[model samples]
Target: MCSIWRTLQRGTLRDIALVCLAVGVIGLSYGAVAVAGGLPLWVPVLLGLLVAAASSEFLFVGVIAAGGSPIAAVLAGLLVNARHLPFGLALPDVLGHGRRRILGTHLMNDETVVFALAQPDLPRKRAAYWLCGLGILACWPVGALLGGLAGTVIEDTDALGLDAMFPAVILALVLPALRDGETRSAALAGSALALATAPFLPVGLPVLLGLSGLVLAVGRKRETEVIR
Candidate 1:
């Protein structure tokens, strides 16, 4: 308990709890959506447990629902999940050793990685990582199950006023990192590029283009160097 409290001193526990809750709600909505779209109750629940990736699962569902190719949906999801490679690399210490490490990597997600990175030290990072990761792992699928069962009655989740919370949780997690000028510029440029291209491109491509914003931030570094 002392260790847990000490870890929370970096102001992680509350945010972790909120993030878990937000993802849980989103998962519930996903379940509701899947069932309403004619998917069996088991499908979303299974995906939630095995896939454990909200973005990828949603894209897959959207594609499949639209009668698009499953191969394309899977490929898109794989592309989205590729971002996890760096996430795994950046979080070696937090992952622990052996069996724990396997579970840790399995539990990894944007929320877990972000919360871990937000911490000031190793112990706190580990605490944040596990807390957020485990919490989401538990919540997301359960929410999906409940949502699937309820989906027959409530097909749409937008009415629940939850559309904003997911993005808000993400923004809250990332806002601190944006304090760095280069990161801030990169984020802005990425968001701008993503938004600008969204209409012209496909659903996931804009997000990939947004990563190119890091290149734009390089320009700022050059300007700063010349000023010095």
Candidate 2:
């Protein structure tokens, strides 16, 4: 406890807690939305445990709400979350090596990455991980509980602009890192490909496009080095 407290102190535990609070409030709305849309409370809770990405959870929830096939829902969810693979791969170096590294990498998700990157300075890698993991665990379960109870109370969250916050927050966390020509192009290309294929494909194409972009990025980097 003493060591953890020191870690949080160096990492500005107050700020991390505030961010987690904000996410918690937002998560309540998510729960309500999911419940209102027809998902059982357990679904979101279980999803929170496994699928750490909000985008993927939203995709899955949307598919189920729309009465889409289960397979389609699964595919769409995977597509939206495929970006995590690269994100996970890239984070280990920053986190260091070994068992803790594995835990941190596995727990790193959209919000956690954003929260960590947002902090210009931090005490230790574990500090960021605790802030993020504890934050998610705190917020999601509470939101799900509230959602179960008050799901019927809220009428139209879309009109209140709460619905837009999720995507905006996720994008805010990601877009800042794309401040380069190659990354920007890759994102655009991947998005375009995904949109183009969405009509004919069964909703898994965005993941495929993202994978393609990763491959392209590697090749492009190699080519640049070769040219140099």
Candidate 3:
């Protein structure tokens, strides 16, 4: 309890709050779309609370809207979220142990991970992670609920440009990582592969194919180290 309070006091509250606001807006867009696509309002609200993965939730809702089978939608969502496997492996210290760890892992989304890692020390990292996670968890569902209700009145979100916000936010998050050479290489390679495969492959599969860029980049680094 004291630890949580201390964590919150570490001066990241404002940043976390801002991120939560952005997430809430995005959640609103998602909920509105889901409702517009004929899903029950409860479905988007539940998915926001439970899934909490923006990209996967969007993909799942899109597949369902397109008349895809539930099994296929589930599989596609899983594939889209598989990037989190590396995120989990990379943040063992932040995750900690026992009961809290379960919640910690569940909260391991892109925003949390990015914010946590940007911190200088372990304490700050954990603090950033928890703050961002909890903030998003709270705001996302509430926004979804409100948006689902509003969907009945507003027929089109695209006119409001909500649809463009998701990718814009993602690009903003990814841009900072490009300052690192290896990350830049990996990102460029992955993006190229994804773009190349976009027309030929199914939606989720291109992302999986893009992951090979990470593998290839790491392998090259290992080979270089061996030569040294």
Error of 1 at 219 (Å): 4.2
Question: Number of the top candidate by lDDT?
Answer: 1
lDDT of 2: 0.68
| Model 1 agreement with the true structure over 1-228: per-residue lDDT tens digits | 356666576456777877888888888888988877677889889999888999898888887888888899899788767768767878899998999898888898888888888888898889888888888999999999998887756555678778877777778878989999879989999999989998987666777788789888898789989999
Expressed as tens digits, the lDDT of each residue in 1-228 for candidate 2 is: 356566555435665676576566666666777888888888877776666556667788888899998898888788766667776665555554787676566567666766666554555545665567767766766765676568766566567687676667657666776887888877777777777777876554555665576567778889999999
lDDT tens per residue, model 3, 64-161: 99999989888888887887887898899998799999999989888898878777689888988887898899999898888888885555667878
> Candidates ranked by TM-score, best first?
1, 3, 2
Estimate TM-scores for all models: 0.86, 0.68, 0.82
Model 2, TM vs. native: 0.68
Clashes (candidate 1): 0
In angstroms, how far off is 46's CA in candidate 1? Answer: 1.2
**lDDT score for candidate 3 against the true structure:** 0.83
List the global CA lDDT of all models. Answer: 0.83, 0.68, 0.83
Cα distance off (Å), candidate 3, residue 17: 1.7
Which 10-residue window in model 1 sums to the lowest lDDT?
A: 1-10
Clashes of each: 0, 0, 0
